[model samples]
Target: MENENWKNIRVPRVSSIEKCVAEFDITQLDVPSGRFRIRIYENTNGKFMGFTNLKIKNLFDGYPEGGVGNGNSITEALEDTIKNFMENLSENRILNDSDFIFVNYNEF
Candidate 1:
């Protein structure tokens, strides 16, 4: 029998991430909410070279959760953060600007 998992496989894209530019903490405003760390980096090398490094970390336990993203600007980076975050977020969880507070925004 032929393998069927090939249809579910996804090719990984090349990354150009060089270094982190800014990182800070943020708190979710909803009930049962938690804190998270947002790190932005500069992508200066590869076919996908860019200006922002999209990464986020769970502050509660220091485990990597949200996937990743890349952008050319801060706004784009944050948008990508939210998008990837929501995709990785648990079911029934809601995320929004007003519901998420930037705890340490001085870094940005």
Candidate 2:
């Protein structure tokens, strides 16, 4: 949906991401009614080495609850943020930007 306020960008899906996203022990934070979950994955090698972060932002209030940190809601916010980051990285020839050194959550 291209518009005057913002341009549209497309991201080619990566099949290999399944393995990476699965490896991370997800750390999620959410306020009472707010809906958002951020997942960070660290790799020993590859482009997503240091810190591979994924965020799912909920656009509405209907986000379902799954366990303590699991939210059944599937929000596009999380996907949209990571997609933009990856696209820019690909353009800059940054095949290994996620390999940044370990640090606290605030640093990420």
Best by TM-score: 1
What is the alpha-carbon lDDT for the whole of candidate 1?
0.47
Q: Summarize candidate 2's per-residue lDDT along 30-102 as a digit string, tens digits.
A: 2222222244332222222223333222224423212112212222323444444344334433223232222
Estimate, for each residue in 15-93, the C-alpha lDDT of model 1 and write its tens digit.
3234555565556543124656667665443111112122233546544344355677655676677566656554454
* Candidate 1 ranges with C-alpha deviation above 4 Å: 1-17, 29-33, 45-64, 90-108
lDDT scores in order: 0.47, 0.30
Compared with the true structure, the alpha-carbon lDDT of candidate 2 equals: 0.30
Per-candidate RMSD, Å: 13.7, 18.7
